[model samples]
Structures are given as structure tokens and as C-alpha cells.
Target: MELESPQRRSTMRDAPWWRPLGPRAPWVAALLMCAVLMSAALFIRSTALESSALVARGMANVIMVAGFEAFRDADGLPDQAALDAFLASHREGGLRYVAVLEEAQPLVSAGAGKVGTRDIQDGSPLRVEGARARLIHRIRRPRPVLGPLTLEETRAMTSVGDVQEPRKPLRMVYEFEPLTALELESRSQRLLGVAVASCVGILALAFAFSRSLAQREALAEELERGRRLAALGTMSAVLAHELRNPLASLKGHAQLLAERVESDTLLAPKAGRVVSEAVRLEQLMNDLLGFVASGELRRVDADPNDVLRAAVETTGSSRVEVRYLPSRTPWPLDAGRLQQALENVLRNAVQASPEGRPVEASVEHQDRSLVFTVKDHGPGIASGEEERIFEPFVTGRLRGVGLGLAITRRIVELHGGSVIARSHAGGGAEFRLIVPARGV
Candidate 1:
């Protein structure tokens, strides 16, 4: 059977759409949030600026129209002085140029001088460049009022250039910077700050939400693993209790039959096979109990070298080689449990090695931890199976259940340590049991 990483399996079986992103979910969400929020801010800023420009344009037209009517109702022609005064009064409103022209020649003008005849001949009513704007408006004479003329009105009409002077199709040209004229610099700055602040705040919130979701999923998976292990332990206890007596009786009868039928060759071999199978079953039962055992450690000050020696002796493999580096300092550990863990790993290495090949073992102090290593001259663990082989009932061998490494890992972790398996560079599988050298 094929096995995969627990996280990948969990994600495939029952995870949210974003569960596959794992630790990167927050970053991904933050990027997407930034893109959307910045886009919105830019759109709003552009819309507001457009609206402001239109309002400024309308106000300029109103002021210019009022001035034009005033010049028309005066007693004499509006000279350059009057036009200059009109422009200066409205300078704060962004008015840079004002002129009254007849047939492309300036009759009166102020601010940046009169428009060029060539520019006027071009016939474009309005021209805009960056923040500056120019508008050309044709002026119309006010019609005579229906009531009897007042003394001031009659006197004004009787001037040298009378109301009868042929209406000169007069044109007024204006140039100004609308945005700067209306003093929108501060308002634009405030809008920019608000936009930037809004985008950052929203991105932060999105990142937080993503992190919280990932954490919640991780907790749920952890709880599920606890439940499965709890149920397995309960079932293993019940089966061990119920099967022990019958298994013992069967092994006893098989061994007695083998002894009595020694002279009967055929019957003797059959009985021998039965006893061997029973022994194997007994070993299987022992391994099962060891795997489902609790993780509580009983710690004591013990020498690691002594523990390694004991494990090698108990394994009883003549081909096992030791590379012992004795440590002068004693380490805190549960000697019996640690010995058992080492023996399990050593026995597996011995079993996997070729006939007459040696299984190597070593122990040494590195930094703040004690490390025990085992290497077997056998076909190494398959690719991608290094971590999976540590899971309960996951064996790479044709014989025996796969609980040795799992038990070893559990015992090591109880000491606040870890176990890792990898293929040796030369040719074999290597296992390391690294544990803290000091008391927990």
C-alpha cells in the first residue's frame, strides 16, 4: 500500500479551498487585498478630481460673464486698464488672461497679453495644457430695455462709438490654471493619505483572517489524530487481553506435538511449522503492545554509552559493529526505555542487512544533545517513505509489522527529542535518535 504525508492526505480528504496554500495563505490574501483596495482608491481619486475640475470651470465662466456685461454697459469703450483691473480682482480664482477682441485684434486685454492672430485663426474654442486652460467666448451686446431710457443710459448711448456702431462680433479669450487656482493641493493630499491608510488597514485585516483560518484547520486536524490514536489504543488493549490465553495454549500444544512425533518425519515437520507460526504471532503481539504504549518517560541520570552497550548485547547479533565514543558526562534519560528503543532500531537493521554484512551502531555527544545512530548494509528505505515509515503499521519489509520506528519515535519525543531516517550516502538506511543531554 502507498502512503503519503499526513498534511497532504488531510488536505485532499477534507480541507477548505485555500487549505492547500498552508503557510502562504496570509501572504496570498494580502496581495489580493492590496490589488483590489488600491484599484478602488485610484478610481475614487480620479472621479473626485474630475468633479472638482468641472465645478472650477463653471465658476470661472460665471465670473467672466459678469465682467463682460459690466464692460458692455459702461459709458465708453473698456480700455486695457479696465480689463487689467478685472483680471487682477479675480486672480485668486485662477484667471490668468482676459481680453476683448474684434476681428483677431485686441480692443482691450490684461494678463499674459493678447492672443496671437494665428492661434485665434486656428478656430479652436478651448485649449488645455496640463493645469492651464484657455477659453474663447463670443461676446453679445445686451438688447435695448423696453422701458423709457434713464438720463445715464441716454447719455451713455449718445457717446462717439454709439449703440449704432456695427456690433463687432467681439470675442473674449481667457487662460487660467483651474486646479491650482482653486487651491486643491491640501484636499488632494488628504485624499491620498486616506486612500493609502484604507488600503493598508484592509490588507492587515485580510492577512489576520487568513492566519486565523489556517490555525483553526490545523487544530481540527490535531484533534482528529488524537481521537484516532485513542480508539486504536483501546482496541489493541482489548484484543491483547482476549487473545493471550488461547495463543499461549496453542503454542504449548504445538511444541509438545513436535517433541512426541520426532521419529515420524512428516508429522514432526508439520508440528514444527505450527510452533514457528505461533512464535511469530507472539512476537507480533509484543510489538503491538509496545507501539500502543503510553508516552510517559521515567528519567534518571545515566551514561549513554552504557545504554548503547546494553542494547547491542540484548539484540544478540554477531554481525553488529559498534563505533562507540564514550562520554564522560552522564545524561538524563530513562535507561530501560532508551535501551528498548535502541534495541528495536538495531534489531531492524540486523534483519535488513545481507547475510554476513555488519549493522553499524554509534553514540556521541553533539552540542547540547546526545545522538544514537544505526546504519544497515541493506536495500535502503524507498524514496518518499522516510517519514511515512515512522507512522504506525507502516513497514517496508516483507516480514513483520511496521511499529518499530513508530515506537522509537514516540519514546524519543517523550524525552523532548526527535528521530529521523534517511538513506546513507554509501549504501544503506540510517536512523538517528537525538535527545537533549540535560534534564527536562
Candidate 2:
């Protein structure tokens, strides 16, 4: 009954900046965490591959230089056996192919079958392609004059009037193994799978936590609303009890005065007005008592159609049309309480409609629940007031106390049912009372 002040309403409307994001904060935090984890995983994988490639390149260069040193014999001539022995010792170190070249001609080579044309291209002397690497080295060839010809001996021979021809350059080509590259890729792919699976698990947990939080908040709001309504009901019951005797006395005195003043034209009209207003106050007191006592229920097996007909009869409006389901089965219900609730809803529908328009009523069974629908050919509920109209002391019209729909909702809830209100497409309002048959 007390209206809210404009200052309090304005303060509520001006909420904090972050209030809009409060409900979605859980999802936002989860997505940000997942993004960070995925980025770290990808960075680590790339770094690991880069480090491995660097190691492979260094090893290939070392093997190429070592092979060139071992290819020469004590007489300063090419030795096939020494080169072959060196390759055999380091084969497990990813040195899959090796070749010695003179003037672009292959002199002696090992593992030549595994080398492809695409593997050897014109590039830097020491280069790496993925997990594989290549290295080229050039070595000097000394002409032999004796069992072992030193650099000084060769120079003396050339200076003593003995001219010598220049020697062709020898080059070594090395190709690292492919198996090492494949193994690295397989390990990285496994790590990627682990990252994806972890993110999925975390997303599931976040969704579950958000859902649980929402349910908890809803229950808390419901408890607070119940507390407030309990206090209001207690005060209402006290006021009704205190006002009843005085109201009855006023109604009786007004009626007696009206009978006595019937011969006087103006006095009779004034006295009648007092009696009518007193009667209206008495009805309000009765409604308050009923609203306060709506929590208790007494269930009995009874026919719902009979209850529907009784409510319609109480409305006593000629413009109302009834459509009842053919089936007549008994359900566990508080006949008196349910009929009272139905009567209130039906009367509201009848009163809201214009004089000539008809109010429609129907009953049906769905999913083991009974549904009672009432539609009035009225202006219908306002855009946002459909829910607020069900609160006690909240009304669209100026006349009468607004306890009818509120009391109806309380009684329906006690019967394990719900009330839904919606504006019909054809310019009216519709209300449905869905009551479960078994659970109550």
C-alpha cells in the first residue's frame, strides 16, 4: 500500500557500472582463462621444435667436417676405407646420407639411395629444413711425391724447375635423417591433444558452477519474499480482527436509520449511501481474513468439473461461456479452497470485460496435470504489469482492494500448481491455472 519515493527509485535505477556483467562474469572468466592456456601451449610447442632443429643443424655440420678429415690417407691420397669407417661409427646420430664430390661428380658416397633431388638444392652451406639439415665442406687435395709429402716438400719440388698442375677441389655433402623430424611432430601433436582436452574439461566445470550459482540466488530471493509476506499477513490479520465489530455496528445503525428516514427523500438517500459503504468495508475485512488463512489446505478426492461449475455459478454472469472436458475423474484437491480460488479468478474475468463481450472458461488435462483457462475480452494486461498485478494491494483499477488474484495465487501454490497470465493475440487477457494431479 505504501508507494516508493522517487529518490529511492532513482538510486536503484542508477546501478554500478559492473552490475550488468554480474550474471555473465563466470563465462567471461572461463573463456579468458582458456585463451591464455591455449596460447601458452602453442608457444611452448613452437619453441621446442625450434630448439630441436637447431641441435640437428649443429650435429650435421660437425659430422661433415669430421668426415672430410678422415677421408685422407698418410700418403696425402684419397682413402675409401677411412671414410667408410667414419660413417659407420656415426650412423645412429641421424647422419643418414653422405657423398664426396669432385667437379660435381660423385666419387664415393654412403646411403645415396635415400637422397632425393629436392633434398639437395642451391642454398647456404649449412642449412636446416624442418627436422632435416644439410652441410657442405670443401677440402684441399695434395699431390703425392713420396710415401708422405708435406707442404714444404711440395713447394720445393715446384721451385726447383719442376712445374706442377693445379688440383681440383673436393667437396663433401651431408643429409640428416627424416625419422627424427617425424618423431618430433608426433610428440607435438600429442601435446596439442592434451591442451584441447583440458580446455573442454574446464568449460564443463564452469558451466556447472554458473548454473548452481543461479539456482542459489533464486532460492535466496524466494526466502526474502516469503519473510516479507509473512509480516504483512500478520499485520493484516490484526487490523481485520480489530475492525470487524465496529464495521458491523456501523452497518446495522446505517440500515436502521435508512428504514426510519424512508419517508424523507434526501435523508433516505444519504443513509443508504452509508449502509452501502459499510457493507463494502465488511467485505474487505472478510477478504483480509481469508488471505491470511490461505496457507492451510484440506485435500479430498473430488471432481474438478464440479468445482469449475460451482465457480461459474458464483460469478453469476450471463456473458460467461463454459467449456468442460468430457472426462470426469476424481483428483486429490481441497474442494473448498480450490473453488474459492477459481471463484476469485472467474469474477475478475467477468468484471474486467465490457458489458456485451463474453468471458470464456475451459478445462483440460495435460501431462498428468489439470489446466483451467479463463479469458476475458478486455483491454488486457499492460506490457510489464502482468506479474506485478498478482502482488497484494497492486491493482490496475482504482476501485476495490487488489487481494483477489494474490489470494488465488497463494491457494494455487498450496495445491502444487502455478498461475500464468498472458495477453491474447485477439485483444484480451488469458490466465491459466495448472495444477498437478499426483504430486500434491
Candidate 3:
């Protein structure tokens, strides 16, 4: 496969808001721009001042080199004779130095009085070809007070060789001024300190701004939630008022038919079933509205055993068994409402239990609280539907409007209690209601 270049890939990844940048990017860019401006200024200054300094240093080196060449050559040094002879033949032109230098060695071959005739020479030139410079002074010999001469000016200067060859090599030296060490250190430290202080300030402001943004987002979210709840409340009130009157009429007609029906006859049996179902539906609607009624609490001390008995009585079944470890326990409850809530849970359990599989009701006192349990043996509810079954208007049965469990939960929560529904160990769902007992 062919590969795309980095530039093309980077362009593809670019998004409008997901800029390859940060909140502080603009501030940092501004700072860098200032540094660039200052750098441009410094560059201009350096170009001007350094150019002048280099010219001045070059001129000084030129003067020093020329004067030193004259003085050094004037002295009677080794190979100086050759330099003088070359000078005599070729007078001063643009030639900056006639470098005739030497060693202090005696030249002899018995027949020729002094075999190597030259004993004097000139020095090499020094110059600053492409740099800043300050070359100064000249020397014929190593001065006792200071040192040997260095001609920086003649570093780029022209030179011509003398006529005679030297018996020994010459020493070469380089020269230039050094930068002041302390001045460089001070400037570097100052720049570093300023950068650090600016970065610290930027980070502190970033933290405060981020925190402020988060708080504003949270407040906006809370306001949105309150608005939604208020709107829902208004709609629910309108819906309940509109539906109740017709529902009452339907219930009345169902009851009239039920009074005239005979249980064994076919037409009457069907009519009786219609009445029973209609009554159940009407009762469910009442529960739905009742669960949402304004008052949430009417706490009172009452026997938990009595509450169980009332729930069983409401079920109107003679077959279901009741069992309790601690039959009587004083529980703080809104007696009438709590009895209705438990009745709803028990009635569902009885319906779900298989024929001849008697539903079991039990009550116990634990940890300063009353625990009531209802168990049934039947085909287990679908796990997926279990939680949804308690949601308003959701049902497992075809005929149900699905408010029983939802109303049960509303009442339990109203009384500062809890309920849990799950499959029982013996084979079916177990619903438990836990409420506080009447005590400190």
C-alpha cells in the first residue's frame, strides 16, 4: 500500500474545535511573539554594532601588523638577511608581511666560514577575515614585561616568501579577545527567572478559570432538571382529572351487570368475568393516582402481625398459608396505606403461584425493624422483565395495566421503608417489605 505524507495525514485529523492547541495557547503565542520582536530588535542591533566593532578591530589589526612587520624585520634575526634581500628586490606593495623568522642555531662547515648565511627574518601576518576583532601591538622579540607578539590583524593579510631558505621552522601563534564570563551568566539567569514567573502566573489563572467553568455547568444542569420536573407535574395533573370520570362510569356499569349475572350460566358467566375484570382495572387506576397523592407519611405504632392479617384478608383467599417466626412485632407504619401496599404485593404473589402451590407469608423482627416476606411457587418471571414490571404502565400479564408493584414501591418509600423482589429459593419470586419497628 502507498503511504500518505505526514502533512496530509495531519490535515485529515484536524477538527474545527479540537484544535492542536490549548486554553493557554493564545497567551503563549503572544508571549512568543514578544520574544520574537525582541529577538528581531537584538538582531538588528547586533548587525549594526558588531559590524562597526569588527571594522574597528580590523583597522587596528592592520595598523599593528604593518608596524610589527617593519620592526621585527629590522632586527638582525635568523633569515632576516633573506627577508631584507627579498625586500630590496621587491619593495613594499600590498604584501602585508614578508614573514622571515628563525631558530638560534649556529651554522657551520669548516670550509665555508658560516654555511647558512641568513640570520634574520620577518614574522607571519594575522587577520580577522569574517569576524569581530581588536588586534593590537607588535613584537621583534619576546618582551620580558609581557609576552611574544600576536598579530590578529594580519590573519587574512597577504604575504610573499623571501629568497633564501631557513635552517629551522618558526613558531606560529593565534590571537583574539575572550568574552567576559560573568556578563554572560547574569543575562542567562535573568531570562530564565522571567520565563518561570510568567509560566507560574499563567497556570494559576488556568486553574481558577477551569474551576469557574465547572461550577457554571453544574448550576445549569440543576436548573434544567427542575424545569423538567415542573413541566411533568403540570401535565400529570391535567391527565388524571380528564380520565377519572369515565373510568367511574365504566365501573358502575360493570357492577350492575355483575349483580344480574348467574355464575353457572354461559352468558352470565362471561358477564361476571367482564365485571370482575372491569373492577380490577378501575382499582388499578385508583392505585396509580393514589400512589402520587401529596401526603407521603402518616406514621403510627401498630402490630406487624395485624398488618399481615389485613393484607391476607384483602386478598380474599382461604388457601394461602401464613407463617411467621415472630408473629407480633410493633412497627411504625401508616397502617391503612401500608396494609394496602402489602396486599398488592401478596395478591401478585398468589396469582403467580401455581395451582395447589400455597403462597407463604412470614414476618420477623430484626435490628429494630419488621421484615415481612411473601413467597410463591410458580414459573419464574423473565429476569429481563422483573425490574421493568415495577415501572408504571409495564406489565407481564396481557390484561394488566401494570401499576400494582409501582404503587407498592411508592407506599413503602413514603413510609421510609424498602422492598425487594427476587426469585425464591424454593422455586418462585420472593417479595420482602422491611420497615422500622416502633422504638428509639
- Please report the candidate that would top TM-score against the real structure: 2
TM-score for each predicted model, relative to the true structure = 0.70, 0.77, 0.45
Model 3 error, position 341 (Å): 1.6
Candidate number with the higher TM-score (1 or 3): 1
Q: 190-285, model 3: which lDDT tens digit per residue?
A: 555665665666666666665565566668776885576456445655666676787678768867776777664767877777777777766765
| CA lDDT of each prediction against the hidden true structure | 0.81, 0.81, 0.60
Give a tens-digit lDDT track for model 1, residues 25-98: 77787788778777776776776677667766676677667676658666455678888888888787778888
Better of 2 and 3 by TM-score: 2
Q: Give the TM-score of candidate 2.
A: 0.77
